[model samples]
Target: MPTVIALTRFGPPEVLRPLRIETPRPGPGQALVRIRAAGVNPVDCKLRRGDFAGTDPAGFPQRLGNEFAGTVVALGPDVPADGAVAVGADVVGSATAQAYAEVLVVDTAGLVVKPPPVPWEMAAGLPAAGQTAHTALSQLGVGPGDVLLIHAAAGGVGTIATQLACELGARVIGTAGEHNHDYLRSLGATPTTYGPGLLDRVRALAPDGVDVVLDLVGGEAVTTSLALVQDRHRIGTTVDRRAVEEHGVLRVGGRSLPALREIVGKAATGRLTLPVRTFPLREAVAAHRLVESGHVRGKVVLTV
Candidate 1:
């Protein structure tokens, strides 16, 4: 039996409770993984609490994990040829539902291998947020000589996206709370204070205007993003789902993606870096509360 973590109800982080059940066996094209580390994401909490209005919740006593870095312990029949992932390959992706457990069931398509170099926690936490940043930049056509603005620059996606934009030859200015200014600078971004005259701070850096924006914080940030860039095509948001449905903020490519393969490749090859804070799987409730604090400097993970 698997001791999976689930929320019997939706409320505070305390709702996340451990429950024991039969270990799942992968079907024809699946594999069973012993989760070494599971990534903690805001979307995980939002969906867990039914606070995310963009889609339906996964069902009560819902298992709560999207990505993890783990070893393949068992393989189902007809698994991918090459069997590229052997019994002990270190890998990451979104397949850890009730993943904050001893073991998990996974689909290969949701998997990305972590070469011997990356640590388990970093590998576990990078996939989703890194991919979201990658897709946002890719879709906006951010490149050399571009000027980009990234909202919530201290958060998981913002930190990764800032570095990526800088690597693309784009002059990146990031909006984060004043406390995180130095942190953003370390990622090669010009930190712009996010409230009260946000554009003034940006204008001080860009002079002309930004060429693209990746909004991780929604609400007013969506309007602020549009106001900074003339072309609406240049702005997109991952958190602002309402903006996508009503106000016209474009949906980023990776949101609808089953998994991010090539972008994860970037992290695997050292083209990207993941910043993470980790908690043990038994501390799942505390992990959710910490991330929800809105003061996290980077990604968080639950260690199995």
Candidate 2:
């Protein structure tokens, strides 16, 4: 039996409850994992409050959490034989819904092995934010000599995106709150404070123009991003799918296309480094509240 957290209803963090239940046997093309840590994101908070409207309504008493790091312990029929899917080793990626549990049953394709020096918490934090960073940067053609702007630079996706863009030799101007300026700088992002004149600050940094803007803060930033960047192909939105679509902003967030394996591989080998603020699984509600409160510098992970 395994214990996991489930949200009873769409409400504040208090609605998240824990329960002890039996570990599920892997179904076809599935693998069972003894979860070490679970990544918490702003999306989890939005889903808890029913803020975003997109996915087909999941059955009630829904399990939350997406990215997680764990070890393979059991195999479902779907896993290929001949030891291609290694068991009893460190693994990381997304799950269908059971990530909050001590054990997770996920698609074999979703799982990837973690190389040495990649901490479990960092691995847990990678799947969602890492993929978003990778896809958004790739889609925007972020590269050397490019001046780019990234919104929410202190956030999970922003932090890694800043690093990746820096590694790729792009001049990254990142907008976070005043408090996070130093941290953003540490990650190799030219820090700008968001709110009350983002464009001006960005222009001051770039002088001539910006090649791309990854707008994590949707709404007005999307419009501002397009205006700031020379090419529309370089602007992307990770948080708001609808607003981006309505305004025709580029979208790099998940749209049923799973990129966890690729994301995990990058993070595991150090091409991507994610920060994890860790908490115990029993504190799932507090973790959700932490995300909802919106002061997080990076991803939050729940340890089981």
Candidate 3:
């Protein structure tokens, strides 16, 4: 039997409990991984609180966590010899609400080879935030000469996006608290304090105007982005769905294997970096509380 963290019912972080279950076997085109680390995301907390119950209701004892880094223990039937991952290979991938377990099965097509230089904690944290940031930048056509404004730039997704955009030759203007301003600068962004007169502060930095916006914080952030950038299509949100329907602003990000590999490579070569806070697997509840507090500088991970 393998242990997994699951929510016995929809509620707060306290609902999360450990359960012993039969080890899952891989199906065709899948692989069984012995998970080394799992990332704690805001979505995991939301799902636990039944935030998306109408669309993605959870069954009792439902697992949490969407991304993980681990080693392949077994390959399923018909897995290609030249596939992206192989048995005994170190890998990282996204999962469907099941990465919290000690061992789990995942489709081979979605896994990326984890480079030797990348640590387990960083690899586990990369998939969701990395892919989302990569996809968002691609959607906004962020590149050379583009001035991109990123809200919540010191957070998980924003940190990666800032570095990636800078690597792509874009000038990044990132919004964070005064405390994280210097931190954002280290990641290649011109950091600005986010709150009260945010528009004016950004204007002072980029007099020509911002070409694109990636909003990780909704409400006022989206409103501020609309005021700064004229093109609705160039403005996107990962947190605000209401703004999408109301303003026709683009909703960015989807699972991308290529993006994952690219980010992993950058991280391996020291071109990209992610600050991580780690906890043992049983402390998932405490991790959830920290994430829910909304003040973590970077990513939070569970060591399994």
Candidate number achieving the greatest TM-score relative to the actual structure: 3
Whole-model lDDT per candidate: 0.80, 0.80, 0.93
- Cα lDDT of model 3 by residue, 1-304, tens digit: 9999998889989999999999888999899999999999999999999999999766787998999999999989889765668778999999999999899999998999999999999999999999999999999889899999999999899999999999999999999988898999899999998889998999999999999999999999999999988899999999899999999899998888899999999999999999999999999999999999888787999999
**What is the descending TM-score order?**
3, 1, 2
List where candidate 3 sits over 4 angstroms from the true fold: 80-84
Best by lDDT: 3
lDDT of 1 by residue, 1-304 (tens): 7677888777788888888888788777787888899888888888777785345655577888877889988788878646766567677777645567778877776677777777888888777787788788889999999988888988888888888889889988888888898888888988888877887778888888788888888888888887788777788888777888876768784642333566566767887677788898889988999998998988899987
Worst 10 residues of 2 by lDDT: 253-262
Given candidate 1, what's the lDDT at residue 90? Answer: 72
Better structure of 2 and 3 per TM-score: 3
For every candidate in turn, the CA RMSD to the true structure comes to 2.2, 2.3, 1.2
Q: State TM-scores per candidate.
A: 0.92, 0.92, 0.97
User: What are the per-model numbers of colliding residue pairs?
Assistant: 1, 1, 0
Over 4 Å off in model 1, which ranges?
52-58, 80-82, 253-261
